[model samples]
Target: MDLANLHFQNPEAFFLLLLGPLLILDWWWHAHKRKSTIKFPALAIAKKAAKGSKVRARYIVPALRMAALCCFVVALARPQNATEVEYTSTDGVDIMLALDVSGSMGTLDMLTRTDQAKLGVMNAEKVLKSGRFWDYSRLGYAKNVMAEFVQKRESDRIGLSVFAGNSYTLVPLTLDYGALLEILQAVDDSSASGNGTAIGDGLMNSLARLEKSDAKSKVVVLLTDGIDNASLVPPLHAAEVAKALGVKVYTIGVGKKSGTFLAFQQNPWTGEISWGEQPIPAENSLDEKTLSQIASSTGGRFYRAESKDDLEKIYSEIDGLEKTEIQTIAYARYQEKFYPWLLVGALLILLELVLANTRFVRIP
Candidate 1:
């Protein structure tokens, strides 16, 4: 039975002051209205008539009226019981998304299956001619899948990073999923300003962004295909930094078993054509083994994303993995019922008026 009240401040003691003035005014007015008494004949007959009447003997009527007024005033005070509850809210993970925008990610290799290639004998012939090729490059596929992933996670605070030859924080950790998707959709292969990959730098940049987050869990989802070809700090060292800061790093390897060729065009002289071909060995391209080791060292898992669907599934899994607990406190506010107290005062004044005009009437 906890007692509390609602007002501009504590108001439980205010009622005592309110009724005091009225009681004093009533007592003073009644004490001053005394008149001289006159001898009356047939007093015995009057006393006999009063004996049979059932009217109140004392001030029962006024006392009953005061009791009713007290009830209404207490009700207006708005008493409430205060309590505290503890519950877990599983939605409080803060994440930083480090995306690989390296030049090699532009290599086209992901293939899409269509119904046109599922028909009959003609379909079989077309399928044979369809050669295994991807319509979009790895970077483009990543953009599409990440856009969807950001839209699905509106409750969590997320940040974005783009790394290639150099690393930069494009969007700091935020809960604005729409803005994050807008940035994702706007990303193009041209955004890979650096010609090389800096996986270590990217991881370090992500950790820096998450430094200010005071959450129960902090994590980084680092997606890269190329090894750290250009970085002052090594990828393994960056992973160690993340571990020291209590940040988990989930590594994603995006590409195929056998990496594809990265294509480029160069023009020399006005309108002169200069086309060349070079095979970037798939083995030296993306260092998945190192990435897996980094993730394992930081109590996180590594995932492989070879296509758009694979990328989406990887993000879905990450979304389910990171979570937080939020506890919300709810209670009703108390309001002062001074208006009802004043109303009762008005009723009492009105009752006094009626009594003076009829039952308690006196001849001036």
Candidate 2:
């Protein structure tokens, strides 16, 4: 009865519907043309009494026949119910997030519990350093943004590599994002023992994780705040190896080195908060030249993020660059729906015949 998605299998059969109306016109013409002779008195009372229920119902037989003819035409058309369905298949990409957790990551640039953007500037060079701003530090913002990036990679296999003076893998390339997030959150800055920034070692460590990958496209996203100082393997050499293996390495230099920044600390026992200034030295500035060379050598881009928002946008850009195009296939399934119409047509025809012979038969 819901014809919204209905269809016909044998549509040409509907041509038979022309017969019903033709039969009706023929019945009307013959009823008018046929002549009958019967002698009877012309009485008004008799004419009024003749218009009884049974007399009126004499036309019901022909109406039933016409309705039956319509049903037959519909039955022949072979109506059906069809529903369409579709599915998508994606050629997935593989990615690795190379993070820098050097001692410099503890230097606060503006990320705080209150999301203050210019915290360091407002309280510039107060000259005190506090280790209590753990969640509002550079490392914390990187981890939070990286977690969001992971969520956007629908079917890609992603891994994590962390480095400072030493580099190592925290999670292998896997599709289980839940397990990866658990380990990523538990990591600390340089294990509190690392001394220098080993940028080359970080890239090489990430490349090693992607060495055996068979994905159509492979990528490494590396972020660091300080210059490379203690890597056994040089950064350019690692970039050559990545290029040879058909892997792209995107590098990000985080934090602003324009002026002095303020660092804050809270007294653990008294719960009092205090702030002081910290200046950026030329030696500890981000090694943008080497990082840029690494990215270009591997056919990737380099980005500079001076704030949390900039870093998020950089990650978003990389995510957009490596996304896989999803292709969908569609088809339809049909179910036969003509049986009820056929059955109704047959029942109507039978009822018409029975009524014509038993209650409205003509003596011809």
The lDDT for every candidate, in the order shown, is: 0.70, 0.83
Residue-level lDDT tens digits of model 2 in 1-364: 3356888878888788788789889988986798876555976765676566776788888798888887877778878898888988878788999999998786777464355554544432233333335556788788888999998988999999999999988898999999999888876784424678888899999899999998889999998999889899999999999999999999999888766655665768986656756676677688889899999989999999877888889999998999987889998788888889889988988998998898887654
Residue 320 local lDDT, model 1 = 78
lDDT of 1 by residue, 201-254 (tens): 999999998877787789999988778888768999999999998999999988
Off by over 4 Å in 1: 1-92, 114-135, 259-285, 359-364
**Highest lDDT, which number?**
2
The count of residue-pair clashes in candidate 2 stands at 6
Query: In candidate 2, what residue range of length 10 has the lowest lDDT sum?
Result: 123-132
Clashes of each: 3, 6
Q: Tell me how far the alpha carbon of residue 135 in candidate 2 is from the true structure, in angstroms, after superposition.
A: 1.7
